[model samples]
Target chain A: MNDFKIIDDVMPDVPPPVVGAVAEARARVFRPHRPHRLRLRFPVWAGGVVAAAATVAVIGTAVAVPLLGDGAGDRTGDGATATATALVDSPGAEEVLDAVADRLARREEPERANWRVETELIERWPFAGDEFLVENRDREVHWAGPDGPAVVEVSRVGTEPLTAADRAAWEQAGSPRLCGSDSDCENDQVPYGRTRYIPADPGDYHLSSVRLSPQELRELPQDPVELKEEILSRWARALKDIENSDTPPGGDVPSDGDAVWWVGQRLLTEAPTTPQTRAAVLRMLSTLPDVRITDGVRDIEGRAGLALTRDTGGPYAERIVVDRATGDPLAVEGMPTVPVPQLKGLPTGSAAFSKLIRRMGWTDEAPALPEGCTPRTKKDCLR
Target chain B: MITAPDEVSSITAPERFGVVFDTHYEEIRRYIGRRLDLDIAEDLAAETFLIAFRRRDRFDPARGSVRPWLYGIATNLVGRHRRAELRRYRALAKTGPPPDDDGHDQRVVDRVAAGVTVGRLSGALARLPRGERDAVLLAAYGGLTYDEIAEALGVAYGTVASRLSRARARLRDWLGVEL
Candidate 1:
């Protein structure tokens, strides 16, 4: 009847020898070692001597000039100098980002009482075996008024049919079409295609929601370094608050660097940015060593852009493609670099999730209902 | 001036680390060993000390004794092997307690009776949510007090109580035991 006693008794016993072995191994590996000045200095001097000798040899060989001013040696030196400078210079990603920042800063700010941000998010996952299911492709339009209540309109574009293998599996599992009648089959098969307008809670207009109020957007730091610090501190505080509430098992609180990068990405995509804020965000992103530049990236719309990719150091990898000419974000895609066990049969490097920004920015006009949509019966409301 | 016997005393970092290890290593190792296989527990136990050693400066003696902190580190390590822990519980549920080598006696008979309950308990523990299971196991097996369990799991005192209560209620219903 003693449940605790039974629980205790069932635990596998650990003998003393095992404990001794572990302790010994730990002490051997992790025990603090005293600093050895001689051991450290020997390597330093040796490296310095070798580097100096190599430099001397290179210079000596260069001194045997082929021409007067622009000799072979001078050319070699110049090439070497240029290569060295290239290492220290701004990378292509940074350069493109800077150009974009400049373009945004120079653009005239539109005078509007509200902003309408429209986005389409596609989520795909593997189900059964070899069967990829496009779970949801939802198009969302969020409107943020200057001083009034924000609103959101969500419409599902369509659900992609199960892959051949998945369809076979679904049929084998009784071919379930959970509906009231045969007439409901079409709607059940593709359950979402109607737009529903919802008034958003005023409290939802925070940085976490990726929607900043005009006042908040204006208050963002213009300086890149200050902005980076601000984002990190805010994210850290949020993470701390979450941890205080419930510590998820095996979940790591992201490091300050990861938080900064995430903040940068969110700002670029979600937050309402002014010219200064946009410039600061780009500048902040440029300072990140991990943001890689890739040329010749095409969005779903087949528009070419430069891609700024950063591995977020998880199962997921995120890439943001920007228009080469305009620097506006064309598409933001997050692909899994490793197999997601939770998704069953999904393989690595699958574009399981993506977000396409169909339209964004400030506008004076109120959001209008879709064509052929009546107020009472909102049917065929999705364009 | 003389210090009171019950008052906590400050010690040098190295000495403190050594004292903490010597005092708590066995209990910490046992805690991890119960959740995971003994082989992995050995390695994780050693790792817990290494982490504790590195983070010794952050350890505040005024807050609580070193035991709860050490157990917390061990519990965190256990959290990392959640899959393995769940698997162990499932395996235990499928296969009842390991065969007893000792000759049949009154004690052996009592143990055999207990084995049946343990098997059911294992199944119930496996079915319990991870957070609730962790709270239950820490209290039932790790011998952590409610406050200590809360500190170890990094949850509120009420959360620890609630999680344990929910887990025990589930177990009570499943096994039809009055516990």
Candidate 2:
């Protein structure tokens, strides 16, 4: 916490001019800052101006925008925020809803008793990071209506298979490992290694249920094409399912790699047409809404980029920062980071090669997609 | 003549921010100086006011004084630069007394202030485990209520209460400050 009492008086105010350089970079990043740098939104102003020491304090900046600014100046309190504006009726509301309703209405089939979503494997591979890393693993969504419960099968695909050493480690790990000799192993069945229940209640909307297994983890492949295909196919399907869920739950990409999926979701079955949307917008303008930019700026494979942070509401928030110049995925990252209690989850740590947090980075080209891939279902991925 | 953050006209709102910092910048600076190294404290303090301006929008009219929120922001910003903080404390532990600006009656004022140092406060503060330290500092300096502190720190409120209780228990023992 800060001690604010005498700090303000001894320090002279920072002139808007002195804050220009770094402010310019911030404006570039956050974009369209008000009342200042009104020059066509994001002008990388050339050169710098040196203001007098008396005019601007020497606290000298560091790409910092003076703390997160206040909402006191917002006149937009009366209306919906820009994001909520889309959900405003805009006369298209009835038509859009009718069309969507008509499509679902055409199904005409009776609702089933048991709702089941299947999570099949799309692909997976190794993922490396600065201090934390893990393989990119994913289980596809299984969409079976009222079919008992969700189920999945796991198998190891490494060339050496589970070595005796691997099997021993598996036992110590309470045996999520498959084909281990340990009698307590939970990996004995197919199409149903585990059947975790996720209630259909709206309250359970944000939950991502999955049986994490070491048997599912595998070392990454050296071949770029094979690895890309495996990771991307899973990535696409997983993206689709998240968009369809009520709660924006995230999970490992239905493939393998050392990547962190930082997913932030805005949950809304009903769009901003309602008055609640306006109130929500007003609240948001004062304090940032649930939406968040991921791990922010970070270096990736030696280039500037951003990682993926998805809100698994629609077609998923899954995305990579393709370099503007090269259009390649410079890195991967995601959010909705839930800091787990100590000793509750896996060891609290990061091993560069073993740790897999995703980030956005520079690229020469768009990230390669699986062959015949379709964009994740477009249900407002920004949520 | 300053009204609450809510009373300021949205139009004049942005402008007054300039004035408020101009007026209070030094007091803020000194407070930070007492807490951290002068140079680093100045930066964090400066950044604090800057952030205060940006976050002016969030200032609740219901919540009159801006002091607590500003401290909260500064705490968060300081948190991002945690290594710098620990380094300042380690250095302060060695540097002995902080540099006094007035120099007039330095010993008397410094001694008295040091006596209240929150040193026991700071020591008890320092004694707290990391999680508890965050809750106590946010409450003591930032004046954040359980909910605000929890939201600011991104933890649950129950956690805030537990940590605060634990920290206060420790501070009470050390500073002997009556709860």
Candidate 3:
């Protein structure tokens, strides 16, 4: 027998394709295939009719916080303080969201072949008694055209003590090495590692591991109820591996509501969602059983917005802070609601993890690729 | 492998591609499944068939048979996910088999031996160049002949022979196993 026969003994045993999966695969070929018409231009807002329709719809009657800003110095802060942030449940979440959705619908969006999102991610991982905060700036450019793949470039910013107390503790511990191979501290947790480009299908963009085609996203249900069902179905398919595997990567499978919230956050922030679909997602989220809205909450950037927060059934409550007037997502925060054994030094109410959305919009300019790398480079080219 | 009359007719009758899919889908899926995660394998398998169906008019039976043609398409799709495949190998090299097996008496002993062989081989496979690794897997996991692999990878027959020879030598050096 050939020595190569040993490979068969090691390969992961795959279960036979299920009936639903087989049918889904079959439909891809049998269905009438038409390439989505590549949209080069955006619709210019025909002011009077669209504005009049939105005015008749309910404007936010709940609160008095101004939403519009000059967009200068708007993006800052990691919100790593040890203060306990309280989220008071309010009935005005739907009203506020509806008004914001109406504004987003009438908002003027630029037309560009590529979209880029620059984010500053700060994560605090507590090991033993000392806590380490790792920061990385990630830039992802999604080419909306059919030919080019999405590119993601990540730079390791730095790792340091999260607080002054933690810094003092670090000094007392002889300022132990936080980086390099010798140190036990692990900072490079973001899966994309250095810089990589993923060859997604035409008109598709990636969010974490899930791929969302722009045409399909734009074609999502406008009605909130129908939209929720659609999201749930797609999410179930994405979560299949986690459900089957005894030891999933991230521990237990998320609850249905948790899964919806997770996907909805990506749709709102990462994926290129239409105004109608964004509105639908917001409305749908407001109705989720565990999700609640906290009005007048300031993000790490010191920008005040409504925090659409959901109880994660853990120490941390996942929250997405969106700009009040424009409804653009400003930041995502994982605020600790209770003290846990793992994180002894961190306070209960402070955000242990936060991703500040510095810039997210369409641009004609493509991201600066690595040396000797172009938009069409299929493999990752290291600099 | 598909020697049936209806299967042979699919080369000419493009409409009969569904018959080809029905016959080869599981086999093509298993070939990719051995290289990558099952979820990704399922997706790439479907994509291979879709591409094949679309390019059926381009099918040149004079060059090769349909089985190798399908493998070619599937291998190309696997190439797109090269990073994920490499990551899988690295993880397996460190962790041995995924803790899927129930620790029974004799089975546990078999698993330990299997895990050791897998770990040693995975480390070597992960180090091989993508071309050599692809050739090795095509012969080992895909159970394709050297000619079939050459056709599948769009390489010369001699190239396949040299790559396999080098890969086998490297595996022997790393694994210290008898070929």
Candidate 4:
């Protein structure tokens, strides 16, 4: 007996689809994207610039680089950096964004030499088996000053199931101890609970693809149009350099709007950008297509803010929620629009990842490294 | 000459994706419908195309053709409903194939023998490991070649061969017939 034919003979034959179902399904392909809040792990530096590779090496941890800048331009088949002509569908969002940019531009604060940012990052860690969705939450502190080598400290808080369904699946799989043995853990997984220090340079900061010193970042053009041009040129040069390299870029080429948004995020979050420059960055982002604003959203920490979302047209949507009053960014998150098969049981709309900004500003206090890590030794600390 | 944005890039143009949808939608729907019911098939089939359109740029032509790639995505979507698939197998094992009312007496007797074989096959399928079962179903229900199954499952060709070998061996033992 032909086993394959036998298997085929047993299966049911479904009738053709209802006449309109196919048309309706095809219509879904071109329907406007509905922006929803999903909390994906913040790629932070990795998604934006090549310099963030330094940050990855410092922590001895490899972060997943999200599909950056693969948005309307990629879909529309316009070449990269086509921001000027991108359609702005949400005028209300533009108004809110403009108001925030104006407020940020007028605000003046004292300049300081040292900066510190404390963040709590929750990432859906990958696993070999599809039994459970494991979320590894960590607390990261980066402190840098003009006079000293920058210090990066990471302390893993915990790792557990991401959702209720994941917990059930874990328990069903005999609850194999996660991150317990050599076989149970991902190779690149940062050791949990203990704070590990990594060496960093104060000058290794990037505005998208362009590396800028603290002084240069502060002195950057404040006009939104000028800033957009500068960023686009820098991204074009970066793309050219990547093309010259032996290895291919490997993923979707980011559009100019994607580049602008990536730089805007970098400026708001980690870069010591002047308030006026930050304002210009926000204004630059408002001009891009598919950038929508949602009022009255809360971050993972329950702080309220207005959310600015860009549907990257990849698996996840990039989101940055900012304080309505001061325009300071409260959180950066990546939310999954499609179900990732590896993350077995994450619910449809639950946050698969998030980074809540606990603290960020100029500081007088020095970075407290882990026991054996010195400020200048340039050594390994995870023992 | 100014190139229209819609036709500039054939690989990622939204307008071009429609061609792919029209070509493969019914075939993909039937594949999913055979594994699960037609109701879930319609929804999942639509979703599969939407996902395919979103990720069209990531499709590497060297790995395989669009047919297996679409099948890969559809198979992945079906894998999401693993419980439903396993339940379907167990239920099929218990009930066997539904009797056709239009058959004659001799045909009915032949169908009864076929029913026993089908039930045994279903039972054997339900017991196979998930990877092996996926390989088997992609071969049987999907009508995909060993190469296509390998690409669809993102596994090596040898792995597909081994999975099919192990799964068919178990089926042969259960049915006591040449596979």
Candidate 5:
């Protein structure tokens, strides 16, 4: 049997009329699609007027004096509605963020021995029909110094069958022992009590991984525009490397706006930044024209702070809450704003998650295991 | 494979999308058609072009040609209909050829012979793993070279070779012929 020829002959020729139909469909549906750049380039001055009118209407207060520009024309009623719908078009929000940025620039980085960051990550997986198994992991990460290797320790702090039905289903599935000596059991069957420590290597640092070396941090431009450009070039080069390498494609290529947002996230959370770099990052964030700062204090982990947010036009919207007094980032939250079609059965916006910055800044004390953690290996207890 | 010259210049040009659609539409349609029914293939092929047109700015021609990239998108669409594909192959294996419309004595004989070969081939294909099957079919029917297949599947070049080798070996064993 000719395998190649048989597979080749599986389909008959596509009828010629289908081609005409597709062409007509493309012309009718797709031909008129315009790039977002055209819409984004509308005059900022016009945006400012509309923003002021909308603010006055929504807040039920007299319009505050325009910060940067004067109200241009009599375009007020429908124009206000349009500006209100477009959440990121607020120039007042930009002004608030710029003030926050100026505050960050004057701030100083406190001296410490190591950088310690604590995070709580919760994950839910669907189990037997209409049930979910949830796991919460608590992680503590320490970098010995700005340029030093990182030591990461993660412990699964809690696990519960998501619902009563889920609990019953778990019992039916043999109430599988967790964190046992047996390697044969399913991962979820094992109890969530183990702590694993990963020792870092010097070469593991990279901009793509969001961990910057001290040298790299020091070299960053203090000027906001130059810093943004440097971040763009660095991130673009990193993406190109991934494309050329055999590694699987990473996430979608970040747009300029996305890159700016990511740099802010990195500085606040992962990047080992000097005080100057951190201040510059905040200043750069303030200058981003599209960023929208929410008015009123936001409470993250019971700590009240100002919120800076940007909608990525994807499944999740990101917001960073900063200490109102210190201008230091207190928490970064990603709440799902839309349903992710790829992950089936989850309700829309149901799987909201956040990464709270429990601790940050240098400490004179060395990294150590948490109390009550029984070391499974010698490396896990290494100082 | 010859890499296309950097098409970053044409990315934002909406008119260039028609050029891409017209050039590769037929081949992409047939590629999906072999793995699925004609009607679904037609719809999917059109959807593929729409997605490509929308994401034109993200396409970097420096990586590979537009052809493999289009095939990659088509392949992902096919992946979603995997059960239907396997069912089609199994059905072909169980049933012999459909009765011929244009009946001639010699043509009838040829159809029967072709049907027998196809039935056995489908049976063998149904037994192959999904990744291996994808590599084999793209190589056989889509006429993609090994490098092109690597780009299409977003895998290492060596991985493509290994998967295709294993798949071909299994096919040979299943067919009881040295091929």
Candidate 6:
């Protein structure tokens, strides 16, 4: 067998205890995929919107936090503490970051010729507790607070220009695979299908030829508000107009694409009470140019969603998650990143599930504490 | 439920959703046997898949399937259960042969490989840093890429590279070769 394919040959059923454990976990934290099911529950949809909105209100605009160096290697120390000591005692104390970053950048890759942007993150904390999709390999992290604009190395996603075929394909899929980072995507179904398009160094990828999804599409009667969401999701017509519109420049905001979103999100949140207001809202939204609402997701509440804008290096959404019943903005959370796909399959973002998803890849349990580690939210440590 | 195994086959294709453990557990068992002791390899291999099933969604579609990630998970479980893995090697080193399933030595190569590996491999593995050891095992044994290793360890891409580089250098030092 090919070395990479060594583990791929075959497998077996897990032991009963393990199977039982996973079953319990699945019930508690995940929802199995219903290949042919698309239940349109309006109230649940509205609840999802509300949940997202709450996330926005809670997470706020700046997602960055001061982590690292807050803990020591003491048995009671958290990631921050251990990282702090690691930084001080690091072999290349002065040049570790530079060396690590350079080594990371220079590593050989499968010469996949496509647009790629790199990110450089500088912090004095080990970001062990979060679910960030770290795009690169170098994590010469220290446990310290940013003395300045903490450096973060990022590779701007080298995206294949929105081709006619890609656009048509996304439309057929019933979800717009618009421009945005993977973080903006839900369930990684990747309506816009990336990573595949990164163009492998050895020409390992090929277009699927087929554009539409095999899954059933939901034709829920979208009321006027839901109509706005549907429009935003129709990338070529709605979102495209926004991306092509004239956007004002600002310190942190992008110059060309986001102004339309700022206005659109405002309108969606205002919950236009009258027909005249709704008309004006739609017209105003229409003016921004093509609005690709590709990063669609069902937030913790369960409403289907769409991304309205992407910042210079972030997600700028003017999402309208209707009460599946009312199809109005039930709840919304304007965000920098979207909920991951697997987590979205759940019925609701229960406290336990939310905590589990955040610690998806790690094994270390949060330390037992006398008065436990006080974290920003339950996602990190106990309240 | 009444018709046939053909009807059952439609519901569970090895390609779509692999077979049950009892029916398809041997290769993984043999894979673990190649490195670890007889005592824990059996159970550790089982725990690996259980954990893999739970975190299956996070598996990258770009990576094609769950096998690699499962191996990564298994590797981690084995790391945590280091003692048992070492015991397998230590027993082989002491006996000058790997223990056979039949309670009798059958394969001649097992005797030579087990005896030769017992001391050297275990000592070298023990000396490796957790990150580097994982990188090496996943690459040399699990056959994962720098990217997959990064995702599995929750470290950055650069960390995977440097860790691999250092790991290779150390393994060479043990093998008495220069990479």
Candidate that would win on TM-score: 4
Candidate that would win on lDDT: 4
True-contact fraction per candidate equals 0.10, 0.04, 0.15, 0.14, 0.07, 0.00
Question: Where does candidate 6 stray beyond 4 Å?
Answer: A1-383, B1-16, B19-27, B32-44, B63-65, B86-96, B101-115, B144-165, B172-179
After superposing candidate 4, which stretches have Cα over 4 Å from the reference?
A1-92, A125-128, A147-149, A179-189, A240-253, A370-378, B1-179
RMSD of each: 17.7, 20.8, 17.1, 13.9, 13.8, 23.8
Model 6 chain A worst lDDT window (10 residues):
A352-361
- Tens-digit lDDT track of model 4 for B82-166: 5677787788788865564232224335534644355676778778877777778778767777777776665567888898899
Q: Model 4, residue B13: displacement in angstroms?
A: 28
- DockQ comparisons of all candidates to the true complex: 0.08, 0.06, 0.09, 0.08, 0.08, 0.04
Alpha-carbon TM-score of each model against the true structure: 0.45, 0.31, 0.48, 0.52, 0.45, 0.31
**Candidate 6's residue-wise lDDT over A1-383, tens digit each?**
13222112111111233445333222111112122222221000101111111121112222222110100111120112101222122234223322322342343333221211221111111011121111111111111011111111112232221334433443554432222222222212122322211111111110010011111011211232443343234422422332243321111111112222333343334221222333333333323333323223454335453322221111223333322222233333333244422122212332111100010011122222223222211111111
Chain B TM-scores, listed for every candidate in order, come to 0.83, 0.62, 0.87, 0.82, 0.85, 0.63
**Candidate 5 chain A, run of 10 with poorest lDDT:** A49-58
Local lDDT at A180 for model 5: 18
lDDT of 3: 0.55
Candidate 4, position A7, lDDT: 65
Q: What lDDT tens digits, residue by residue, belong to model 2 across residues A1-383?
A: 33222112221222222345334322221212334312221111110000000011112432222112211111221222323322221344323333332343233323333222222211111111001111222222212122221211122222111235433443554443222111112111111232221111111111011111211211222222332333334434544543453322211121112111211111011111112221222222212222233223342223443222322221112223223232223333221122221111222221111112222111222222223322222111110
Ordered by TM-score, highest first, the candidates read 4, 3, 5, 1, 2, 6
lDDT of 2 by residue, B111-136 (tens): 34545342233344345665665556
Instruction: For each candidate, give the interface RMSD after superposing the true interface residues on Cα.
Output: 22.2, 17.5, 17.7, 14.3, 17.1, 16.8
Q: Per lDDT, what order, best first?
A: 4, 3, 5, 1, 2, 6
Which lDDT values do the candidates have, in the order given?
A: 0.51, 0.31, 0.55, 0.59, 0.51, 0.31
lDDT of 4 at A153: 70
| Displacement of the residue B170 alpha carbon in candidate 6, Å | 3.2
**Model 5 interface CAPRI class:** incorrect
